[model samples]
Target: MTDDTLEDFYDAIQDLGHPVLTAEELARALDCSQEEADRRLSELAGVGLVGRRDVERDPVVWYPKEWDQQARRERVVTFPNRREFVVSHPEQFTRARLSTFAHLIDTNGSGDALYRIREEDVWGAPYDDLADLLLALRRVTGERHESLEEWITRQWKRARQFVLRTHEDGYTVLEADSESLMGNVARQVLGEDQLHAPISDTESWVREGSEGEIKRLLYDEGYPVRDARDLDTGDPLEIELSLELREYQREWVERFTKQKAGVLVGPPGSGKTVAGMGAMAAVGGETLVLVPSRELAAQWRESLLESTSLSAAEIGEYHGGKKEIRPVTIATYQTAGMERHRRLFDERRWGLIIYDEAHHIPSPVFRRSADLQSKHRLGLSATPVRESDDEVEIFTLIGPPIGTDWSALFEAGYVMEPDVEIRYVPWRNEAAESEYASAVGHERRQVAASNPAKLDEIRRLLEAHAGEKTLIFVDWIDQGEAYAEDLEIPFLSGQTRYAKRERLLSEFRHGTREVLLVSRVGDEGIDLPAATVAIVASGLGGSRRQGSQRAGRTMRPVGGAQVYMLATRGTEEEEFVRDQLRHLQRKGVNVIEADAETA
Candidate 1:
């Protein structure tokens, strides 16, 4: 049939519930002559996509049935499985017949075969008819036929796929993962309360170990485990554990131990690492902490040792530079990205896993998180807002959010909040505005960098906050270099040597250096708590996450402090600042617009 006529026929079937359009009806719908409509219907019928069924009483009238049983038979025989049937008749029949029988079993709601069935019923057969079909199939195959035994064995495997017997009169869907599939099933079947009834020991054990291990542990503890795979592999090793958990941190441990996965979002220095350590202590098993950068990984190693009784030998570091996986290993995300290294982590299922700087989780790392059945999972970050959709993946694989409010940390005197100020500078001359405007795209950022108008303003802000520890945040290396050269302050960037970075950070930490200029490297996981003032010379286009990290640098409670963000008026920078402010506002950060005159 012609494409136009076929489209019309399909649309008519959808709208009118059948393709039985008379020539007269088609003529009116298509605005064509009756002869033309009759021609199209003839072509459609010839193609076997539609058929004419004669009415018993009306000799001239007929209805359309899209393809009768003969046409359907031809199509079904041409299917891939049908071709295989013609090539290997008996073997094909065995497999196809078994699959069909399995479907029949499922339709009847037989617990053994229910996993194969998707619909409520097949044809018009009632539940009892399914039982009769099973008996008939068994008789046709014969009691001694190997195919019959194979089919029954396959049914057993399929049955195990759906139902998981946890305890006496307690069951859960076997396919459930980090997000509870059985929990959802229970809500549909038994209502919300029964599904959410404080998770049992078996459920909690399953959250921590593999299904086999959970079954084995339960059987060993005399819980009448039926699954053979649950056989014990012997007692798991006991690892050293020590932690001082706050009330909130201890409560978080209880919830994590029960649920097995969750996130911890709190501002910088709110004890995310410490709380995660406490959860690991509760697990009392080997732990691995993953961080975004090597620096943060090292910082975590130190923090864990300082807060707990873990010895230097107990903790190992894994990153681009180091390669060691101790009982309690601390690894950089970069190392986790390595294929071979990731395999090692997968092979060794740590009891508890912690993600530091959790917002920076990449897609690959998030996928790897799924293969791990860690009994306890803890994601730590001051800003859990991710820059990509991978954030949603992390939320699914890592579990749910569990922690106290960031502002509550401030209220409880756990972390400090800084005073913030925003400064705007307009180009003083026509030549400067033209230069700034002409620098669009990549050059636009450079134009804003070397505006010369903001140099003195940056110096002025530094002068006002002089003698106090200060960090000048810049976007471009050229801008940072120029500022460092003109201001005679130490500078650090990706180009800086490791030794120089160590020295610069040390000098800043001590009282020797009053001012330091840095690029994005210093945005997060750096301990610059001594610095009380931050001058943001360039901003990362509307990224509230970046803004939070930049502002958080000076938020440490070394007495009250201030944050200054410099933006060029009548440029993309203004719109960028507005976008960033929107993100900060959601996090309870209010940005006030001011000028140099106010300072």
Candidate 2:
């Protein structure tokens, strides 16, 4: 074969996403005979462009001669029984395809990725047509996985079996695709309080206050109900975004508008808050913004006033310190879920309800607010995973997962992917190791996490990255206080007075403050846009969400970002850092480990 033909053959195999392929597989992909493929491979190998190897199943496997050094093949291994897939060096297209029906679980900095395909992932798939979803699955895996496809088809059907629609008589009704589905699925799962009455064999009257419950129940039963009810879009308030949205942000808004509800899942500094505001402007109705803390509530108000045409009088904070319900109201999850405060929210008709830092929605206290009815629901989170693995509840309550993949945003310059490093520090002294060894249960983990040696490493990192805005995160309040004192920076925790907390965060945002030692309060809610470096001194016990969120503090569009996680050497802290960062690694973020002395 000519050199051009050989190059063409190489390109074709590369497009298949596998660096090595047997003659049979190569023939199928290239539409040539196996003998022809073998002959070509032999010739290519002779030219020092290809290598041939014998494996167990395949007598001969052909790959690029430089595959070991130059090829970053997208290697995908599927496990149907466990519903898991391990993909290494997944290309952009492969990742995009897998994302339609699979949940990314873990990854290493070496490009090995783990994904799980749950019933909810298929049910909440973005594809409107099953054929499209099936095509994507086939494209990603390079073959028809009959068992997986059958399961996905069933889930796709189940997700579409029931629809909550508005009846001409003005009441909400649950409509099923078939009478059998209505009886076997909706009627069987829903109580009389939820399904008020049977209007027809396939339609039933739904109670006013039971819409969220009905959806949740049906979802728990492996059937996702499509919500099409004419929900209340509260008093019309005209709003427009004063700032321009990036292309992906615009796509997110368009998707949310079509679905009327979804959680925006992207990395920090990808402008999910801006996208949430876009959804608000598209809704053109009163919006209720729910946050995990009073700090975020205040930030949301400020962002609205600055990014949108909303005035200070129009946006009100309805948390503990404030109780003003204006056109756009922001409330903390704790206060909004309270019985006394819930009535106020229930009384008003909100056109849009934005859940800021929505990963907390699965917790009992925060879950209650998710039941609030609104015409549009928009959830914003950089890391949506929770320790309980209650991600299903989050999607069911909010909507589907919507947004660009983290890797895509990082590559597109929409968000900066931080260089994450875990520095293993030795114990402060023999006494510290002794104390940790003597402790048991949770105390042991705490002792390891709060190792005093981390303070020296933190100081060194701060000095190396001097003049850059930084955030020091600690899970323990006492450790955070001590670190603050050592570093001579303010320590902001949950116990910090509201006024002081607000002032400190404001200073951090405006660059008046260079560094802040913060406790768990800085994990999710507060936005420190100017932070260029994040030093995580201690983290919650192996909480992947916490790890991702702390690192996210420095993820912005402009400038380089760095995350340094200090782990006590030869302790559980080492394992915790690995477990926590695996999530980011799977999203294509690089993570490296080093000794504190060198770091």
Q: lDDT for each of the candidates?
A: 0.60, 0.85
Across 232-287, the per-residue lDDT of candidate 2 in tens digits comes to: 89999998899999887898898788878899999988988889988998989999
**Candidate 2's TM-score:** 0.83
Candidate 1 runs further than 4 Å off? 1-246, 362-370, 597-599
Model 2 off-target regions past 4 Å? 1-98, 105-117, 131-150, 196-203, 540-542
Write down the TM-score for model 1: 0.60
RMSD (CA, angstroms), candidate 2: 6.8
TM-score of each prediction: 0.60, 0.83
Model 2 worst lDDT window (10 residues) = 1-10
